[model samples]
Target: MQKLRGALIGCGFFAVNQMHAWNDVEGAVIVAICDRDPERLAAVGDQFGIARRYADAAQMFADGGFDFVDIATTVQSHRALVELAAAHKVPAICQKPFARTLSDAKAMVAACRTASIPLMVHENFRWQPPIQAVRKALDAGAIGEPFWGRFSFRSGFDVFSGQPYLAEGERFIIEDLGIHTLDIARYILGDVKSLTARTLRVNPKIKGEDVATILLDHEAGATSIVDVSYATKLGTEPFPETLVELDGTEGTIRLSQGYRLEINNAAGTTVTDVSPKLLSWASRPWHNIQESVFAIQQHWSERLRDGGETSTSGADNLKTFALVEAAYESAASGSPVEIGALL
Candidate 1:
């Protein structure tokens, strides 16, 4: 297997983990790194031991001769950079939200399709060990036939300390943070028939809503209530927790507040913690989607080498982006919106 020489376009806060993950990947190596900020670029380059560095994406793409490019930049720049990668005939693994708008996401997918290059958006929340475990549990019928489920992320994790731009963005949880949760719901459940969402701006300073509650109507007749909040300020260790509770006809499972699950039926009560946990980065209870970098990067490397699509391809992620758009429309119109209409 040929090792894919990689180039990271952004050396911002989260890029650090992606770089580290690339180094850890068996058949991939980050040959080049680029960032507008020299100081941050130098710091990341020095830490990662990469010799090739560029201040611009074009120069990096031209000079590095990378097999694949990692666009870990912001949402606003994803389309242009990803298009640049496609033009360069380099497979791209970009960071999420795939783009600021659904149209931009569609354009990115089309551009990559036109160029015959693989385009993957790094939507890694569902790849996290705990979420993956929940996925496995659901598949194994540990929670029986999942009729309903909730994907909740309530935290005051001070995410702005690193990415301050999120504090000022016009899109809130559903588009930004909740986007991952909504996609997880879709992955665990199925295609959404329609959805009604209400957004709340608890934080006065930010332009977007700090909290949102989404009512999802899946095609399989499962009703899911997805709640996402960046304003949860609990004075406890479990303050910033992701709550996932699913109830089926035969059993029920819950994960949150120290992760307790209970199942009751003729088979007797089965109660235990179903939380899929891993080593925390920086602080405990790592909630950032960035935590799944290793999983996402490994998947990217395998797909890039084996000639397959990523776990979160731009085209596949269209459904996820549609959910975000529908949430916004539903919130604005105070009505349930059809997922297909957004497409």
Candidate 2:
């Protein structure tokens, strides 16, 4: 099989993990890299040993040498970069939250569909080992006919230390972190029918709401609660861990702290450790997320090579992105927001 040459745009904090992941991917390589910041571009280029580098995206697209492009830039730049990739007839993998707004996301997807290029949003939380374990248990009927669920990600970790811009955003958690948890809820339960939400800002230092609880009515008749907070302080911090509770007709499945998975049903209770494998480049606390980044990127490479649509293809992620939009609307209006109407 011929290796797929991929160009990575953006050399930010998270992009380093992506660069490392691309190195480990079986059928792909980062032949080129682009970043607006020369220092970042040079640093990543030197680290990855990528010779081709570009300061301008248009220049990179014009002199395209790679088969696909990975846009790891912020949300504000996603639509433009994806559209540029479409124009260049290059398959694209964009980081989430896919775009600044639902309308922009829809337009980006439409552009790629028109160009007949595969477009994937980097929604990797569902690919986390523990999360996948939960999904597998659901598929195996360990939890039959899931009726109610809760996806909770509460942490007091100082996220601002690494990404100071996070604290500056007027729309913080829901757009930044909650989007992942919301997508995870949709992944486990099903597509949502409607969503009602409430938001609060416990930390006055930040501009946006630090806490949000969203009530989702799933199309499959299951209801779910997605709650996220950066203000919750615990005896032992569950930073970066997503704790899940699922109740089904047969029994229940609990994905607890420390990657512990428990399933209770007619066969009796079974407990297992579903911890993520710590990659050599990964660190403690963030290893789970780092591992997921690799898993999703590998999935993208395989799907692209096989001419198959990715799990988080642009068309599919619009449904997940709709939940983000619905959550904010619902939180502000104090009413249920219909998912269909927004999508």
Candidate 3:
């Protein structure tokens, strides 16, 4: 089978991981790249051996020869870029924090639908090996109808060092990190019915909240908490790990900090190691996320080739993106925000 040709826009910090993953993906290869900064563009193009580089996205789209376009730009450019891809009838994979607002996400989805092009958000947290294992266990009835759960990611690691723009944003943790956790919560426990959130800005140096605790009422009557904090300092920093606790009618599931998965039922308790594979270009702590990037990109390639809908399709991601918007709304109002209303 001929590999699908892909074009990647925005050669930033996270985009490098996407580029590395593209190299690993079986069915796709990035043939072109675009970035506004000539120096960064040249750097990534040189690093990845992608000779086709453009300083403007529009020019790249005009001269496009690729099967799909990966929009790895930041949140602000998401809608415009996705719409541009849709205008060209190119299947697009957008980086997470899908859009600035739920409405913007909805419009992007509509644009793609009208163009008859596939649109996937790079919501890779659900693609992580451990997270997928938890979902698989739930599917196999290991937990027997989960009712209560918690998805927690707390760390003091300096994320701003690599992406200093993180500290400058007025909306921080929830948008940057918690978005993944929230998506995982939805992926495991099902869609949220309502959400109530409280946040704090612990680090004075940052403009946005570093700590956030959110309560979610799942549509299937399950209740879950998504708590994330960049201000947390632990002896053993979990960093990018998302610890999960799931309680069900028959048993429970726990994904601990050390990539340990424990499942307890009436029969017995079983402990297993559910660590993500360290790819050649992936590093510690971030390998889990890096692996998921490859997984999701591969999935996009397969789905685009097979004429099937992607798991994190724009329509589906609107629900997850809604949680982010609702979080801020709830944090400000000190009241529960209805997910249905936001959707």
Q: Write the per-residue lDDT of candidate 3 for residues 1-343, one digit (tens) a residue.
A: 9999999999999999999999999989999999999998999999999999999899999998999999999999999999999999999999988998888999999999999999999999999999999999999999798999999999999999999999999999999899999999999999999999999999999999999999999999999999999999999989899999999999999999999999999989999999999999999989999999999999998999899999999999999999999999999999999999877
Off by over 4 Å in 1: 237-240, 259-266, 271-283, 287-291
TM-score of each: 0.93, 0.99, 0.99
RMSD of each: 2.1, 0.6, 0.7
The whole-model lDDT of each prediction reads: 0.82, 0.95, 0.95
* Candidate 2 lDDT over residue span 1-343, tens digit each: 8899999999999999999999899999999999999999999999989999999999999998899999999888999999999999999999999999999999999999999999999999999999999999999999789999999999999999888989998899999999999999989998999999999999999999999999999999999999999999999999899999999999999999999999999999999999999899999898999999999999999999889989999999999999999999999899999999988
- True lDDT of residue 123, candidate 1: 85
lDDT of 1 by residue, 208-310 (tens): 8989999999989999989988888877645444678788877776665765655555577766665544534433555334447777888888888789878
Worst 10 residues of 3 by lDDT: 95-104
The lDDT, on a scale of 0 to 1, for candidate 2 is 0.95
Give the clash count for each candidate.
0, 0, 0
Question: Which residue pairs show backbone clashes in model 1?
Answer: none
Off by over 4 Å in 3: none
